[model samples]
Target chain A: MNKYIKLMSFLLLIIVTLTGFGLYKAQASSPYPELKVVTTDGKPEYIEPFHFLGFVSDTQNYSNSSTIVFKDGHSRYMEDQTFLERIDFNYNPQLNDFITDHRSFMRGKSRRTEHYTETEQHVIYTGMESDVYWNQPSRGLMTIAVLNKETEEEETFSVSLGSDGSYYEVSATYVNYPNLTILAATNHSTDISEQFVYTFDVENPTEELTETINLTQEIDSNGGVYFGQSFDRTERFIPIQSVRQTDDSEFDYTEEIIGYFAFDTQMQELIDVPLFEEDTLLFADNDKLYVGKDLGDTIELHEMNADDQNLDLVGSIEMATPTIGREEGTHYNNLFNQNITLLDGRLYAYETQYSDDISRPLFQITDIKTQETLFNGTIEPKDMAKHDSTNIDVFEFRLDTLNN
Target chain B: MKKSLHNFLKFTNFELERLSKFLFALMGITFIANLVGYIYTPMKYMGKINEYIAQNSATSEQAIQQYGPFSFYNALNSFWIVGPIALGISGFIFYSFFIWYREWFGKNTFAYRLLMLPIHRMTLFYSKLVVVFIGIFTLISTQMISLFIGYPIVSAIIENTYYVNQSLMEAVQLHPLFLYLFPLDLGFFLTINAVGLVVLLVLFTAILMERSYAVKGIVLGIIYAVVALTLVLLPLFLPDLLNNHYILYGSELIIIEAILLVIVAVLSLFTSRHLINKKITV
Candidate 1:
């Protein structure tokens, strides 16, 4: 009995001692760095810090996305890790069907004059304004319809304009005649709103005038037109396209190719810029467009004039090669996408690497012109152990200015 | 061999009869604790919400809508729900060690009597193991049954309008312990139980070692336990270490874990059988 009491007491002491040691170790090894902010005592500021903005999207699910913008050096040491904005691109098929059905009703009533040209083979339609319809109180839904004058086969595409009118852009591409009406509406509803339609005649351009009157203006001139060009004027325009691969497989994937376009909002004209399919828009500052292309181990950068739309070859930076693995010894390899942002003339590229374990962000920053790397590191969140599965695919990184 | 099998069954029955009162006490205590917690927590919130409504007439509807109803989810947050689980787990852990030590201690010296039985010495070890396993399962089953009884009692106390009622299965998921122990997946539940059995076997072997050689066996038991624990955890970390990077797919990881679980269970049971038959002191 005495031995039993002694054994129990000894075990209790060991447990208590170990627990104390663990707590002490935890207190000593803090995850976050100590922050020291320089405060001004009623003094005037001299130079303002540049703010960076970018977004991260789940490559697996494009709708599960977040937009983050932080000031230089603020986020690196801050305790509150909440993003500036988090957007879940929730796909509402019912809302989309509703918008598509009512789109002709909305667009047919628009007062904007329609422009058309006729060719020997095809009748080309251009500059037909469509009204944006908001069914839900928050999200603005807009559908654009393209009709083949020969077959009368109409194809419609819907764009979700967030509460802010600047969320998405309307773009149409003509491939051939049943294949001719390739109406693509890319949802770039993060920062800019500019619409563009690329039209090409397969044979000879033919003109046939079909009268479609703008009835909303006729019905009530005071009623507002919801779609077309953004109501607010902005200097920057970014057009992003999510290219979907139609290969018959379990993993239906979409890759985003961010394109840069300079729009004269007043003239309603898109400056025709030579955009390569591989080129992804990084950042635009001081009339200069920075674009990046993934070359496996490195990212090739190109500088283009935003005004004249001319491309200049900039140097490339080497990136960390992401380790790829097959799911259950299958042929399909995992998807990896990179997001880039420019701050203080340095380009910050974040690559979200996904595997069986939790997905973590790998970042590398470099000088835009010289292509010299400034810093390369990974941010390990404290709560990484909590998530046991790979659910997150997209992550956006941005920099925003601090309020004085 | 036939006589030994009969003795094993008889000893297991005797152990169960001896443990019946203790098991009942544990269940009764946990049941009362959970019942109080399920009733008290929501009633306290309802009282506070009602008081707020009385003071503020303008926002009464909104306040009632937000906080008036007590739910099974709300009851899950109560100490009674979590406390019983904690108690059961702690008690099981204590009894795992005590189940072996109790035979060596006390006036009768039950270990000597147990060893002197006409059955094989391993039969004695197996009987003790069966008792502990039965005890653990009983506690888990009792907690589950208690939850079903507590659910309706909580619903009756709180108004239906205020509470967002969930089904019994949903309520089980809301509670952390119930979610882990009573998993919807049969394979996952079996896997967890298999791992638990491995742990019990390893512990039993360690105790037998300590009983054999006293102070010298303490060092041996510690080393044995550490090695066993490392072997059990090797599958989780081995692939990454070998490949020089993390690339194991989820399905591959599951397969690795299953293989490791089988290996560990076999090793633990084999070691315990050896220790009981050869090394253990009477």
Candidate 2:
């Protein structure tokens, strides 16, 4: 019994201490006030059950910062999420089941979400890799891995792009069975970046075709090419934008859109996409691509038809043109700070609306095809008395899509 | 089964008794070192801040601007706070091998006597495993409990104006090294501790292998360790080797890796049991 005393005491100590700590940790509440989006004008059903329009708090300190996700008329903090929910925050559990384990560590495509695609019979992962040697030309290689869903057989293919540059960024991947396509943007030692579409036969590993998407002749001095931000598996066209420096200052140069085009995935060719107006924003939603032009009072949406190489009128969404500068020298109008996104036949515009006295973070969801403003709401603290809007940095408030 | 369970508990207690002195010493070291850290960190910070204020004719705020507010995280990063932690980790790691070796090499060659006891040989293994686990948990609990006691002492020592109020969780969150050791997330905690358990099992198996065989057994033991490690980590590197791609999802990979570790751990236990029962010589 005496011999057991020390062991029993130690065990009891460990169990009690850790249990108390665990309970304390579990019971601890976040100091930040809970915030929820209050829908004033429209139905809450407009915000999808699974889908959420959320803002990551930009509090100066880590302790005060939180992620507020608004869905179904209720707001949830990321910290309050369960273990599975926290895991789901990065990758959907069902999607994660089929997706590659090392997606986060993929070379040059770590930040990209479109590096993997699932076809009817195949699951594919593709990325660009480069090996840089000291005082020598770096070799760029296209890395692709294809898995047959039926047979459960997998094959890896690597295509060399000669000794051009060290850094290659793979933005998106598409699999059309044997034909695997990748969009790679390469940056060279000359401070210039070029985009290319590399097509390879997954069945026959040797054959490769590379098409230069960004033509040097088309790009005038101080001009660079950029692809659209959205990547959809079903979309057959990639939005292309050519920009040139409008202001010539070396450090503080402003870029202006010089050209717009849609690169057809099926045809392997580029078709001119007519811009609705200057400063037009392009977003790809599922199979349809839309161009949005922010007018003072409304944002006009124009659908880009790749077959016709022209623009078709979609619909106009009514929104107040934010004032040019600060409201009474207190709040700056940063309404169009984020890209107006078109997702799943809906248009979402999230902005922190600033006024003379108060700044309200708000979101508007509209049916893109119908142009009907579905839901209009402002994010506010549930306990309004505890809300300190000043502590919220409006500039740092980012509205991110919860999951793709 | 009941007798084995009783014997297992008694053996576990005996194992605890053997390591109790060293465990107590580790706790004492952790306490004194962290206490020194809590005292010295702020005093040195103030000493420098005050000197700067006097030299430059600056306010505390300006000096604080130069050197950030004295947060508990500042003490957390100090050597005094982390040194004993490192020592404790190294101590346990060393003892993991020594715990087995000391019985064979001790004055009377106690391994034969321990084996002769009226109990299943597997009880010896389970008892040692539990003792090591208890020792580690005790150290972890001590560190956490000490932090609860020390944070207020640190705050009291530093001037209220200059000190940054941070909870223990916040301080841990701020320090990446400590966060890895003491993760807030349950998933991470479970995953890390499971990996640690697998490591301890592998180490135990290797020690038993060396004990069972002679000089040539050292090489055999090394091979065994390499094979065990490769088997446990095969799920992680399997896709890369086989297909040159990540075939499994993160959760699937984690699940497979866990299963592989369990398999390897069971194999190690069986192998060690066989060695202790048959192959080991005094």
Per-residue CA lDDT of model 2 for A1-404, tens digit only, reads 77689988999999898888888777765545676557766765564432343444423244445555544456566666765545545422223333334343332232234566665566677765432112234456666777777677777777776555566666666665677667765656446766667777776777344655554334443566666644234456666667675656766766666776666777877776666544566766665667767665677778877677567888887753342211222111211123345657877665556554455666677787787778776666666664443233233222223322
Scored by lDDT, model 1 comes in at 0.49
Model 2 pairs whose backbones collide: none
lDDT of each: 0.49, 0.67
Query: Top model by TM-score, which number?
Result: 2
Model 1 alpha-carbon drift over 4 Å, by segment:
A1-404, B58-60, B65-69
Give the DockQ (C-alpha) for candidate 2: 0.21
> Each candidate's DockQ score against the native complex?
0.01, 0.21
Which whole-number lDDT from 0 to 100 does residue A1 have in model 2? 74
TM-score of every model versus the real structure:
0.45, 0.70
In the range B139-188, model 2's lDDT, one tens digit per residue, is 98888888887788778878877887667666765566655566477777
Candidate fnat values, all: 0.00, 0.34
Among all windows of 10 consecutive residues in model 1 chain A, the one with the lowest summed lDDT is A326-335
- Give the local distance difference test score of model 2: 0.67
